[model samples]
Target: MKGNETPRSTLWYFVVAHTFWKNVEVESFLSEYRFTIVIFPTMLKIYRGANGKYTLYDDGISLDYLQGDSVQTLIKWDDVAKKLSLEPASKQTATRTFQVELIPDGVTKRIQYSGRPVELKF
Candidate 1:
């Protein structure tokens, strides 16, 4: 990540017009996730179907880094982000981690938890 790039941590929110809910086409309320690079100016997201299957959304992120069940499989997150070079300082394997969370019913429709990349090493 660029040294000058101050990490931006903001929630990705969705505000339903309420009318959209009344529309017949609105058969359901969908579950979605937003993924942000935290430090880098990158954000990624995915959706969870009623069937529990996941569909990815393109938020200007390369499919390679967050291409898999990265959010669900948070164990190797550091490695994945590094592979994507989202963190230029990631040369040191297993160095840092980007925390991810999926929040539902949060005051608004939004991806939960946004902030600077916090290092959590056991």
Candidate 2:
């Protein structure tokens, strides 16, 4: 405990996925036969902050790709904001004061475990 430290409500984490590329491939089986396929891929970006906490900010596809319409598997930013507490942390003041408490690894681990039960099978 520092003398001039202010404890924060909850640390924020962000995770985001964006459409990076779309491609079509053509293949020839024989001299007179041909096949074509279309492919779309998304790129995921994650930032690991203090104590190994992950950040995921969603624009659109991550929610659908993760939980879909009817399932409640993954937690969204809105849900996180509602369920957990939040405090603003700026780059300037972060250096001077301990504005946030280090959430125990076990708690985050449980959250990560419970949030996404099913893995995307390829």
- Which 10-residue window of candidate 2 scores lowest in summed lDDT? 90-99
Against the true structure, candidate 1 reaches a TM-score of: 0.17
- Candidate models: Cα lDDT each: 0.25, 0.23
Can you tell me which runs of candidate 2 are displaced by over 4 Å?
Answer: 1-39, 50-122
lDDT of 1 by residue, 1-122 (tens): 45434343344533122101110111112234533232322232212112121211222235544543222212212322221112222222232233222223112221222222333221
What are the clashing pairs of model 1?
A: 1-88
Which residue pairs in candidate 2 have backbone atoms (N, alpha carbon, C) closer than 3 angstroms, thus clashing?
Answer: 14-55, 14-56, 14-57, 15-55, 15-56, 15-57, 16-57
**Residue 60's lDDT in candidate 1:** 29
TM-scores, all candidates, are 0.17, 0.17
Q: Relative to the unseen true structure, what is the C-alpha lDDT of residue 91 in candidate 2, on a scale of 0 to 100?
A: 17
In the range 1-122, model 2's lDDT, one tens digit per residue, is 35433333222323333211112222222223543332222221222231122222232324552442222222222222222221222111110111121122212211212222222211
Per-residue lDDT value at 65 in model 1 = 42
Off by over 4 Å in 1: 1-46, 50-92, 103-122
* Per-candidate RMSD, Å: 16.8, 21.0
